[model samples]
Target chain A: MSVTMDKPPVADGAPRPYTLRQPRLPRWTPPALALGAAAVAVGIGIGAGLGSRIQWGLIAGLLFVVGMYALAARVEGRRQAKDRLATSLVWVCFLLAVVPLISLVWETVARGSKVLDGGFLSHSMSGVLTIQPGGGVYHAIIGTLEQVGIATAISAPIGLLTAIYLVEYGRGRLAKAVTFFVDVMTGIPSIVAGLFILSFWIIMLDFGYSGFAGSMALSILMMPVVVRSTEEMLKLVPNELREASLALGVPKWRTILKVVLPTAIGGIATGVMLAVARIAGETAPIVLLVFGSQVINNNPFDGAQSSLPYYIYEQWAAGNEASYDRAWAAALVLIAFVMILNLVARGIARWKAPKTGR
Target chain B: MDITPATSAAPPPLSGAPAPAEQAKSATRPGDRIFLGFSRGSGILLLVIMAAIAAFLAVRAVNALSHNEGNFFTTFEWSANSTPPVFGIAVLAFGTVVSSLIAMLIAVPVAIGVALFVSHYAPRKLATPLSYVIDLLAAVPSIVYGLWGALFLVPHLGGLYSWLNDYLGWTGIFAYHDGAARSLFTIGILLAIMILPIVTSVSREVFLQTPRMNEEAALALGATRWEVIRMSVLPFGRSGVISASMLGLGRALGETMAVATVLSPSFLINTSLLDPGGGTFAQNIASSFKESGEIGKDALIASGLVLFVLTLLVNGAARMIIARRKEYTA
Candidate 1:
């Protein structure tokens, strides 16, 4: 390389300079090209009388990618152009995915805010007619809370114990079988879980529709999520901690109960709460099991109940403008509720992250 | 002796603590025995629940299948309450498969692109927040998506649907007759959007775990950025992406509210997706549950049993792929 630079290279009959320099586009090239593509796309869209700005945007994006690749290849060679093309496509993909998400949130909040007020939150739908406007999700809120609370109560302990069995005491075929079936159980659809309870509790045993039945189905869905998350958290508790406790002559049970549980409690709680958040939004199971009611049913064990998600479905099915507004409001409440749980769960995870200093 | 250390850690032993005779067995102390039993019982209980779900669904499905006057697999109408009840899953099965197929086709490529962008293309500051947003988006409930799809998306999709019909109507699948945009095609798009976040996050994780040395070696060899990714990253992440897509497909197949809310259910199978006349199993069960009698409920359960088995197969395939990939990596 030094010899080539010092003395010019002789190619065929001509002498040429041997320098390590390649032609490259300026940093502003992409943005400038994109602006040109947008202008051209908009001009064509206006001339052709395209109905949607989305069509124009798609045209602009396509032009930008093609134009960038052509100009880059001319100046900077094939490899650099290919790289730029890939980067631009990735950006396009990112924008495409993000736009709908933002729209979904923005639409929900904008429309949901119209009917979401104190009265809307406090009253039940019992007195309100399906075609008439004013109603609230108070009954649904009560039903969701009770049903989800009961589900959490039933599943959290069993899930925790199952996770403990897998992590702490698991050995041989039983443990392996438990682990395999847990993975299988995780994939059971919420509707299928409801169907299971439907066949068993409602049909076979001749029981009436109740939120308690919904809770049973929910626990089925919740259990696997809980077990998976808790198992991960428990695994994060270093084996050294367990060994340390056991080396002190502490019994195995005491070591697990005192040392391990305390160490992982924050993570365990976070997992449980996240699982609750997941099951709380479930509508399919509740639709089949709780058998949604219009009035507030305080007793989850005795009668049919409504939930936030179920209310949304029911209101939407009513298919009127007023019912549509109520559905939006309920959806807003459900999103906010689930988001809060998620934020708090993540916060707990961070606050109580194991300080093993690994 | 073990009891002594454990009890000594506290100020006082409880009155219900096991007697000395029971505690004398060091390995089989009453506390250990009971805890083991309790935890093991919980594990066994989970297995039982899984078994019970399959057993109950299968039994009911069989019972319903036996009483059908029409061929259960061939009949198109779902009237379980009629005399000599006859209902079949031909249309439901067709609708479910086609809608989920459409969803998978649209979602998988876009998800891989988003995953690649988050893992490799975006700057660190941008990548972190972008991925966090994706994570939160995944947690957004499907019912919310269903509502949004019904109210917002259906109305807005008119132009695009017309555009597709105009350009691709020669293909029978894209034909449209100026009907409401509540169709299997629309449901497919909604399901795609709903499952995108999950597929993207999983693939992003796999892309992030691509061995750094492999990537750097390609880079050091003067390969372009895209070449480096193509040679080292995509190959390593291929199985991961496949499994991620399978997971998304499983979700799309079993999704209820979004399809139920978006698609106008009809018992007949339609050749054109743009026509609002196809019904999925989950959607059928959901929309039909309200008015169904005992026999109707039993029929819904039978359809749900099919859905359960379908998801199980998809999920099982995904798990197998993941398990195989693990062995390769290890």
Candidate 2:
């Protein structure tokens, strides 16, 4: 029987039929592919066995999935599966680390919100008992304001001037020494700052526990932060501005005051506020310096004044449910204040960032 | 204009003399020079403040030393209230070092892992939010950490402590006592958690700065993703990791509230990690300052001086390492 074949018509002296070719495999391909796949599977099996406990199960599962991918790739193609597995593993690790942080914030807000009320803000622990839960952090808040405010007042100008001198007028041996000391101070433990202030002011000078002592402790901690931040900000003020002011025959100090500082004021303010925030939640130094008090002490130089940190410690350590509730509320308040300060600092920085384009 | 022209006369310098107007403008006034001098004097004021802090600390520390009765370095006992006072920072120093080392051991690996995960592995959309969460952790006050450790972690760690004791009892470091509620291990763990965010943030930034070309080349060579990270990103960020670790160490060494809350104070030094004793320098100061006698306060001050020196040395080393890396980069 004659069968009709669909074939190309010859343009020249060529055959009209087409030929089918056989697909040939390389001799080493199967064994190499099998070995790689086996190795991956064995590794994953071992990992899975070792990682049966904890979240290691997740890792074991991932390794097994990768092994399966590798085996499948050996049949289809090698590169595509490897890429897919690696990408998947990366995502798993990212999510694993992210979960705890969200949980922590969520827990804090949920637990801390229960006691956050107006009554919690306006009164002190003076009237409330262990069972009753209506006291406020008025004394602690006031003390915190007074002590931290005094500390800022003491630290800001000194730190700013030091930074100004370092960036503007400093060049020689003394400047180097100042820089060295400032670096040392930056590393000094908050406890050491407290000890330094406590020893010098209280033991040596015979001044007892007070908000002033806390301020001194906070100042020691705050100064280094202020100096570092301010120095960075001042350094960022373009050198051309300095030269311009100099060319105008303005005095160096006047140029710094009128031109340089004014230009960098936004950054300087932000830095100062950041420094304040950095020290506001410090508990160690204040614990050492300030005495806990239920009643607010108006004057910083008086005896036994309570700060927010001290208040938290006192309330929590008291071991009463009511006091514990108050402590949580106070913590919430402190955290909110610090958050606000940080936001403000960020805003100032964004607002004052030098305009580059028209 | 016409009146001015009528009154105008030639004001010219004669053969070898200068006009009074020229002389008046030629030299700077002494007052101006004095003002310049005063302005320079402000720099001196800065120096003075710096010197004053150091000087004040030194004097107080010296006073503490002179009044102190026992060998401040070797003696483990801290009996500051006795008439013939016998106390030392040996216990405190040991606690500080041990806790900080424990913290570093826990924090370093986790921090690097997290940093690597975020910078190299995390998707673009997830990275920012993850970093913001870390920032929030950093912003949470130390006292909050203290409360969390005290209320939640301490109670739960008992099981873990027993497990450590059962499995790792041969090693003195992991040995456990009955009371696991207030122990150095808990303090160390809390400190690790507290410093984790700082190290992760800094190291993440550093890892992010790794040269993309090198990473791409490694990947192009058929290297695994982790292999590329090991070969390119880690080497690039080693100095930064070291710096970040030091910063974390600095915080861990000085951390007060968390340690204070987690630990139960004891005078004697115990090697067991789960023992509810061993006070850190900050904890000692915080716990004792209110009730301490004058000599006791001085003793605390003396220990604080040691911590100060230790931290200074640590940060100085970190700065030097960072500076050397900058030089290499330059």
Candidate 3:
């Protein structure tokens, strides 16, 4: 090989005229490439078509893309095997993550649309039965709002204050201990929090099931999330502000209240909303503490009250098709609420982020 | 009112005169006293809430143990609704551990792979959209996951289950009787899917923050892309990987909806992963809490206490490891 390379170079000192023969195009490459591109185009066209027909398009598009890559590799050789493997794995991971999400949303919409009328949202399930399922989840919705409201009321202030302490005055052994325990609390199973509240309020204190106990349970779950997120947000605030506030002769607490918190208020609000969204979907704690009911209970301290999660559980677990429809509708409503909260938080955080130079 | 700097300055001089000589003599008074008082009081209150949660859980767990009719730890039978209410969380614990282990096994590698691809291999234009998709995955509620798992995944996994049973049944863990759609393996897979995006996003952010100079230096030294990641990226992100895994495990262990929807409950323990009756702690609590009698509820609470301890231990260990890493690096 070396001798041939040297001979060719020696003969072509002024650049050996390599013969540029009119090359015969390979039969397979063009057709295969064309077929792959056409397949992809047809897949996209079908996907854009109406209704259930779109699924075929999606499947076709996926297959076409794979086919295209495979054909390209066959023509190109095996040098890019690692890249191909990585690309395929990335898509596989994405599909694994996406299929369940799309399925869930699709199922929710398909089933919930049956019971998503004004009547379902407005009417209570007080009169509905297993045999006949015509009523709505109004009672459960109210219970969820009220219980979560109470939970937020209990958790937000304490969580924010504790975060303030951790960020501002966390210099000693006590702070270290608090930080450790908070981390531990952050990972407490929702069921355990429910159980703790159940044991304390119901078993230990002999109090009957109530929405208040549910709130307490939710607060336990919500507090650590709020504290951790708020602490993070607070830490992002610059120390210069604190120094400037102190230089102005402001008291430490007042400086924190005015300068530090306001600067991070947007992030704090987002964190709090995220925490609320988190606990709002919780089912276990409320199942143990609030105990689901059909009729709406106004008072947190009263008997069993329904929540959206518990309602979904009760309805779905009934095994009736109508009840299942109701459950799906309730889940849709719950998902809507959570998604809205997340969106609003994201919006606020984005809006409130400090303006920087372009 | 003339707000005079003169008055403020005068007061400081007088205060300073008394503070310099008297501060030495009465150092424990004034500002020091107030600061110490506020700090200690707030610190103690925070500590109390933390301690209270643990203390209350311990007390209730003890009460449950005393009232429990059977061996609390080892009994796989959950007959809490029986005449004597004989039960234990052994099955639940087993299911929890096994499912979480399986989820970790499946999710961590994929998550790290996704993270690496996004941080390094992906086109810059594609990174944002890819990340946004992953974030959306993280945002979908767990209940939606349950609904999806129950409706779509369970029905579709029948073929896969039969394949596993046929090929790997000798292992006992993958053994199946009649190849049912519902199994611990399905639950584990669902859990893995659910946690994948979370771990991926966190790990991606951490990997993106790895010092560019270090990565370039490795590449400049004739290292391949994979070698660069292995030598420069993974070591820098070991703590982050652990944290992400812990976070994913936290979600997995506490995940109620997906498990409850997928796994058929049985009290008896079986070595087969395809057994329809395996229960996790969260699943047990979610499924039984609604209709459970009073004693049954207590037993559920006791089981929840165990879950609580397990999560706390896992999270606490993660935090400790992270803190130690910070100390080591600093």
Best by TM-score: 1
- Give me the runs in candidate 1 sitting further than 4 Å from their true place: A1-19, B1-24
> Any idea how many clashes model 3 has?
1
lDDT of 3 by residue, A1-358 (tens): 2353244335544554555321222556444644665576566555654223324334544564476457545533332323344555555455555665677778888877887988888888876786586999889989999999999998888888788878887787878888888777877777777877777788789999899999998988888888898898898888888999878876677778888889899999999998888888888787778878988778878899999888887776786778878888988898889888888987898888643323
RMSD of each: 5.8, 10.2, 6.9
Give TM-scores for every candidate, taking all chains together and pairing residue i with residue i.
0.93, 0.81, 0.84
Model 3 Cα lDDT, one tens digit per residue, B199-282: 899889889878899999987975546667878989999888898899889889988877887788888777888767789999
**Candidate closest to the true structure, highest lDDT:** 1
Per-residue lDDT tens digits for candidate 2, residues B178-294, read: 764698878887888888898899899989988899999999986667668878998999999999899889888888888887789887789787878889988988887777777
lDDT of 2 by residue, A210-276 (tens): 9999898788788877888888888888888889987887766777888888888888888898878
Q: Deviation in angstroms for A338 in model 2? A: 0.8
Decide which is better by DockQ, 1 or 3. 1
Candidate 2 residue spans exceeding 4 A from truth: A1-100, A130-132, A356-358, B1-70, B177-180
Q: C-alpha displacement of B320 in model 1, angstroms?
A: 1.8
Give one clash count per candidate, in the order shown: 0, 0, 1
Q: Give the TM-score of candidate 2.
A: 0.81
Q: Candidate 3: lDDT of A112?
A: 79
Give the Cα error of residue A252 in candidate 2, in Å. 3.1
True contacts kept of each: 0.72, 0.38, 0.36
TM-score of 3: 0.84
